[model samples]
Target: MADQRLERLIRQLQRHTVVGLDTAVFIYHFEAHPRYLPLTRVALSRIQQGHQQGVTSTITLMELTVRPCQLGRRAVAYHYEALLVNFPNLLLVEIDRSVARRGAQLRARFRVRPAEALQVAAALTHGASAFLTNDHGLARLNPIIDIIQLDD
Candidate 1:
């Protein structure tokens, strides 16, 4: 029964056509955060179950690349690339003029930091209905978009 209920909830979440991923999600995926693994499984399971629209901005990808460079983990870098390449359900959003303009506007109006604005702009640009993040600042932007914060 518990498994059934969980599956039902996962299906409901997946029914939303678009979902956005924040940088921390990528970090968590790489670093093996205890709580993150299960959620990652849920997300992957959702995607495998036919949830087709998952997205993350180039910024998050860039950020994820940094840790390996900082740690001199070239192998990890390759692993990261492989993960992104193989993940059919995840889409990578690039930084562009429209994204910058919208991000600037969000910064001005919401007083969001530039990084957060870019993140939100990418999500919005991708037509995401939910932005999945572990950042607290996203809660403040909840008025601007749907934010799902992962507190792990």
Candidate 2:
């Protein structure tokens, strides 16, 4: 079960139909580290249950597969790729022209990396009311979209 603060955050996010996911969410859930795994897994399970729809940049596919691919664990990569593509309530957003342009703008304004900018831009482009990630640093972007940091 989630702690009080996390539970509150999840309840608040449930109010919105669509939420943006960062790559770390996928990594943490699939890899399952001791400290953060529980929260990340529960959060994803909630989305998978169709309670709140999840939207993520297609870049997530690349990010999720890199390690397993490097280690010749093709099956591991395939599992995550399939999950991202086939999940019913989840929408894997692509970095199209509009997203690229907006991502550049976001990059210029905030102290964010290109990947983070792209993820945030994808969420903004598609009208997601909240963005979820373990990166507490993204709280700086709250003015543009609600930043829901799972690790916080």
On TM-score, the candidate that comes out on top is 2
Worst 10 residues of 2 by lDDT: 1-10
Which lDDT tens digits does candidate 2 get at residues 1-152? 45775677768687787889999988887888776677777667878898888889889999999999999999989998998999777889988999999999998898788999999999888878899888887888989888888765
Position 32, candidate 2: lDDT: 83
Candidate 1 stretches greater than 4 Å from native: 1-12
Give the RMSD in angstroms, all C-alphas superposed, for model 2.
1.7
Q: How close is candidate 2 to the true structure, as a TM-score?
A: 0.91
What pairs collide in candidate 1? none
Q: Write the per-residue lDDT of candidate 1 for residues 1-152, one digit (tens) a residue.
A: 54554455465466578887788877886787876656666765666566757888878767888879899998887888778667778888889999999999889988888888998898898888877777887787778677776552
